[model samples]
Target: MTNVRKGVWRMKRELYKLLLMVLLAILPALSFAQGDPITQARIFVEQKQYEKAIDIYKKLYDQNPTNADVYTEYLNVLIQSKDLKGAEKLVGEQQKMRQHHPLSYVDMGRVYLAAGKDKKAEEQFDEAIKFINGDDLMTQQIANAFSTLGRDDYTLKTYERARDILKNPYFYSGPMSRLYAKSGQIEKAINTLLEAGPGQQGMLEDTKATLLEFLGTDKKNLQQAQKTLVKKINEQPENPYYAELLTWLYTQRDDWDGALLQIEALDERNKENGDRLLEFARYAAKEDKYEYAIKGYDAIIAKGAKLPYYSLAKSEKLGVLFAQLQANYAYKPSDVATVQKEYEAFFAEFPQYYTSESIRDYARLEARYANNPQKAVDLLTKALEQPALRKDIAGRVKLDLGDYYILTGKVWEASLLYSQVDKDFREDLLGEEARFRNAKLAYYRGDFQWAEGQLSVLKASTSELIANDALYLSVLILENITPDSNFVPIRRFAYADLLTFQNKDKEAETLLDSLLTAFPEHPLKDDILMQKAELAEKHREYARALTFLKEIHDKHAEDVLGDDAVFKIADINERYLKQNDEAKKYYELLIVNYPGSTYVQVARNRLAALQTGTPAIP
Candidate 1:
């Protein structure tokens, strides 16, 4: 009997163990049921268990009456459940609890509007606005609430009331103008924004941004803005801001001549010693408005040589002329000579400018357009000898000299110069650029191992441009070298690249084409296409460049150069072809297709400008 009892006790222990395992298996399910109450309530609400959700919310609200999230979600659930009386009671309680806070009134108004109580909703909205004491936060809350309700009219009223109570006419003008523009009251929008004139604190750029949105390549709207700005300028002739806006409007309309006239008038009226004109000229130059830029700079130069702006105007005008000629593929030898003579005359007049940026510009003109790389080398060499030259300036001179050396087929000299700058500016972007150039020189000379070694280090460079270039070159070397040690294809490709760098573009194209025919399956095909595109761009053959770039984009989009091709295509379309629509399309494509690309931010900025009808300054 005792033995039988022992067996029974062992069986009982086994049963207990089995029961404990079953409970452990179900523990997770029980834990899930006891998870976050709000989440559980939301799940129940989604399943149409409104009663359960309301119970949870009621408990939450009871625990913390001032918890806005709990109250908002609870009220939302009640309204969705068609418990109108409950929702109304909840909102009313909240209103009383907060001394009828304006936002609570807005909440009540939203409820009334939901219940088809239009009259009561309007009353509630009016009450909310009446409570506005001109406090910025309160006014913003009331206006934003009305806006959220799609009651832009009430939003305007709220702002208007706040403006009146505050006795500040320009109060909320930025937002108010947007409202006016949204309702097609563009003239009212314009007037409201400009009424405060130059005294409108921080509103000018906001107003411009608003106008950019509405005026968006609309001829009629642009004309309307122009007329309004003209009237404002006339009414407040002393308000330079009005004149500035008028000038900006003219630019938006592409009436650059009109813009220049306005700037000149402002400069003369303000007795600014051509400061404003100089600024306008610089802007025009940056926009590639060469004709008007030259005109504006000439205006400044006519102010007399002894005036503060005269020397600057002369120097800047030379830059414009050089830029104009550079951009003109069909420019004459006489045009080159004319610009060269201007540089010489300027240097003759101001010998001290040998150390200035103009000297580098002069060297670039001599080497690239004038076909005098030797002369350019000589010129920059002399500039380097200047006493007390800025280290950065000296570094830049060396880099430019290196390029001229490449042009002159002095490869070793160019490498040496780059190495000097690389050592001198060891921790600067200038140094990174110099290192990258030396690496590129190595790649050009078929020293792939050395070039790859240098590029690996530069892939972590602080300069985005340098790092991107380094990464590309490093990948190119790594990908092209076959396991069997065959370097023929990549070697020829690098040689072609070197030819292109040396301005032997025809030779480069020939070599690249031959390589394609010889090694039909080479991976350097996209690279070759990119090089050809760059060559076309250099010669201003934008259509040809687009053809090459489009091929790379369509055929090798998943490759490393995809974003580079897209950005270049967009740039060519916008800056050279003036195809704004095509430019916008490519920019948008880059942003959507290459979100992780280095060019994403620039693409977004350009796309925004294009969409807003203010194409970026190329």
Candidate 2:
């Protein structure tokens, strides 16, 4: 009997030990599974399981009566469940326990508000603010509690009372600004935000961004901001922020000159190295405000010719002038000569630019505008020999030189250069450019088969310009030629275009007119007129150009190229003819007629500037 009892006892002891080990292993998991009572209550409340949430909150509050979060949640659940009496009793008990607690008063106020007892709620809210005294944590807690209950007035009062108690002037400005904005006192909001000062720059910026979100498109609001910023500038002239803000506001209005004025003053006042002016110049150029762009760059150059940004400014200024001429397609040879002189002076100071895009632009001005293909070829060839030139840059120079070679009738030389660049820069934009040029050379030599083949590959180029040009050329070849045989008219027209490029204009003109007479219904009618218009513009006979453009616009108004004629006519009036009223009318016509044209926005902008009397760049 004793031995059996001993075995049984030992088994019992082992069973107890196993049970204890299992419990030890699962204790952490059990705790994790239970999670936080408050979180569980919140989940139930969010799911609209208010009864379950109330049970959990009651248990939590009973377990920890001093836990403000638990008490607040319990009261909120009671109010949400429409048990107003229960919420009131709970808040009353909390207030009795912590009679002087500001948050207890806030809870009471929330309960009163939930019961539709407005006067009681207001009294409790006042008591809460009174109890807050000067404590930051308590004040913020009460203010947040009031805000949650939609008592924005009380929320503002809470912060204001705290600021007064603490004897701090700017303490409540951040929250007060939002309240002011909500109340439609926008100027008060602006003043409150400015009073916040430096330490709260992030908050200030966030509030400003919020203001801009709603007020950005409202001109009156923008003007209000402008006026306030100007007032601030006058009050504190040394504050760069005000001036910067005013400049930004001007840019938002597309007032590039106004922005330039502010930026110039700031740059001078701060004694900066023209970096700000350089940035403004680029912005003005992007907006097509060439006059303001030139002024901005000139301001930078006026700082000194040896500044870090001077060379860049000089180069970009030339580019802007070139763009102005291109936009209008009207230029005086004297104007071109003047720009070349500027390029010459700039190059004298920075010959290292010989291998850059600036030098290529200068060469293009000579080759295309000044009628000096040899100069373009010589400049690019010398640039190519520069050992320090970037390899990609050297490839670009080769491509450009090939173009000049084509213009000078060195077709074989141009073909060799193009092939070299294509081989060296395979799979790059420069290679695409070279290939496109070679394809054009093929077309110029009356080899449409070879031209179409290369163009088919280039239509998918990543370079937009190359792809667009390739597509345009491809369409011309396909539409003008029969499927089974080469088209003689297209071949002859291509030859004539090459002749025009080579400055053998009389021969080119004869060929074009002969083709027009030979085939009166040919698809190249508008195309031939466009060529003639370009030739007329080249000779500065803008009236003749306008005549040709009008012919296209009047007879072929529905053709694909009609919009080009309209825009060119508008530009000529705007620039060469100085008939701003007529220019405005033409631009408006283009806008109304071709709503989807890519030139519509450009026309609209020009029309606006014309109507507003924004001065054009000389």
Model 2's alpha-carbon lDDT is 0.84
Off by over 4 Å in 1: 1-45, 49-117, 135-141, 213-215, 329-334, 409-416, 432-461, 464-501, 504-618
lDDT of 2 by residue, 1-618 (tens): 699999999999999999999999999877876797777789899999999998998888888889877886788789889999989899888889998788777777777877889899888888888886787888888888888888888888888888888876668886787797787777877666665653355554564565575455678767777788899899999876667767877988777778988998899889888988988888888888888899998998887867888888888998998887666555677888888898888888889988788889889988988889999998898898888899888888888888899888899999999999999989888899999999999989988889999999999999978997898788878888777644878988999899998888889989988988987778888888888898887777999999999999999888777898999999888777888888888899899998987789889888888877883433
Q: Output the number of the TM-score-best candidate.
A: 1
Could you tell me every candidate's TM-score relative to the true structure? Answer: 0.74, 0.64
Residue pairs with clashing backbones, model 1: none
Clash pairs for candidate 2: none
Error of 1 at 533 (Å): 7.1
**Model 2 TM-score, all chains together:** 0.64
Which residue runs of candidate 2 sit more than 4 Å off their true CA positions? Answer: 1-182, 195-197, 200-211, 214-227, 230-239, 250-262, 328-330, 478-486, 500-510, 522-618
Per residue, candidate 1 scores C-alpha lDDT tens digits across 1-618 of 699999999999999999999999999877877788998999999999999999999999999999999999999999899898999999999988998488888889889988999999899888888898889998898888899889999999998998999898777888888899899999998888788546766667877887898778899989998998888777878877778888888888889989998898888889998999998888888888999999999898888887898888998898899989977867888999999999999989987888888899999999888889999999999999999678899999999999999998999999999999999999889999999999999998899899998999999998877888899999999998757756998999999998887789999989888988988767888998999899988877888999999999999999999999999999888887789999999998998999999889988888899888878754
Q: Return the TM-score for candidate 1, rounded to 2 decimals.
A: 0.74
